[model samples]
Target: MSHTSTAQKKLLSRVRRIKGQASALETSLEGEPKCISVLQQIAAIKGAVNGLMREVLEDHLRAHLGAPDISQTQRDEEIENVILILKSYLK
Candidate 1:
């Protein structure tokens, strides 16, 4: 999609950072890192992934379901359905 094309650089950056975090986590496992330190790295990775998800989701909403030409009622329903899917996905 055009929106994704526009966001390609930003999305790839986030993915690269997430990959670095995963590498750090693996390195930590190979050493004697404290449990809390390892957990913190894991948490950071999770947060980064969630941030990426949020950005992609927002772009999808804006470019597709939130298009200005759609009827209001249909747009509202589509948005609600997207929200429902997101909620389930996060659980």
Candidate 2:
């Protein structure tokens, strides 16, 4: 398959699974499961999102973010952008 197709498959698979987890979380609320179960579901969603981000960031870095043999200035720019991304999510 083409790269875009492969990437879409991966993303779609992850999102579908995440949707199921969210549904389970909602059902769990009806039964009044422990707080931990809710936390786990939330964590699973976060992890799914993080995995997607990792895949996208890797692709971006390989395709456009930086050269394999980037100059110092280019490397600095890429590093700064990555740091900014992390900071944005951490906030």
Candidate 3:
């Protein structure tokens, strides 16, 4: 099985925290629902997830695009992938 590295492990921990925040939002949904508080928590979770995505993207770029010439084809591919991710999820 593939294993996560140290940086990935840290990112997973942060994502788990976000999952807890999302669970809290769901539980709150069943209650009278503190609207503003629940919304704030949701926003926080979204931001955390975004940060995790950014970290993964940066790691991919570093691992795949390393070279004296950052203008290489591999670097271009990395940038294109990042753009695709942003377009698909961040928008």
Candidate 4:
């Protein structure tokens, strides 16, 4: 099974919540809510996305680099690849 399979329910719940947050933001815009309230919703969405990303990254690290069956050289290569991916992603 894929790494995400283990967390599928939780991830889906998070996504649903993010969607709700987006919907609320849209409704707030229609209702002319305070600027701070809108900003807070935006920040909440950002935090949700970041939390999902962090969970996936941690799962990848544990599945690949932390596997007991993986050789040292393979682990080192995986680490480099992960670092490159992170660098590109961050940019």
- Per-residue CA lDDT of candidate 1, range 1-91, in tens? 7999998999999999999999999999999999999999999999999999899889988888868898989888888988897889789
Query: Cα deviation in Å at residue 36, candidate 4?
Result: 0.3
Give candidate 3's whole-model lDDT: 0.77
Worst 10 residues of 4 by lDDT: 1-10
lDDT of candidate 4 at residue 4, scale 0 to 100: 83
User: Each model's TM-score, in the order given?
Assistant: 0.80, 0.66, 0.77, 0.76
The ten-residue window of minimal lDDT in model 1 covers 81-90
Instruction: Put the candidates in TM-score order, highest first.
Output: 1, 3, 4, 2
By TM-score, the better pick of 1 and 4 is 1
24-81 in candidate 3: lDDT tens per residue? 8888888887789888988998889888887777776666665566667768887787
Instruction: Give RMSD to native, each candidate.
Output: 2.2, 3.7, 3.2, 2.2
Query: For residue 49, what is the lDDT in candidate 3?
Result: 88
State each candidate's clash count: 0, 0, 0, 0
Clashing pairs in 4: none
Q: Give the CA lDDT, 0 to 100, for residue 6 in model 3.
A: 50
- Candidate 4 Cα errors over 4 Å, as ranges: 71-77, 88-91
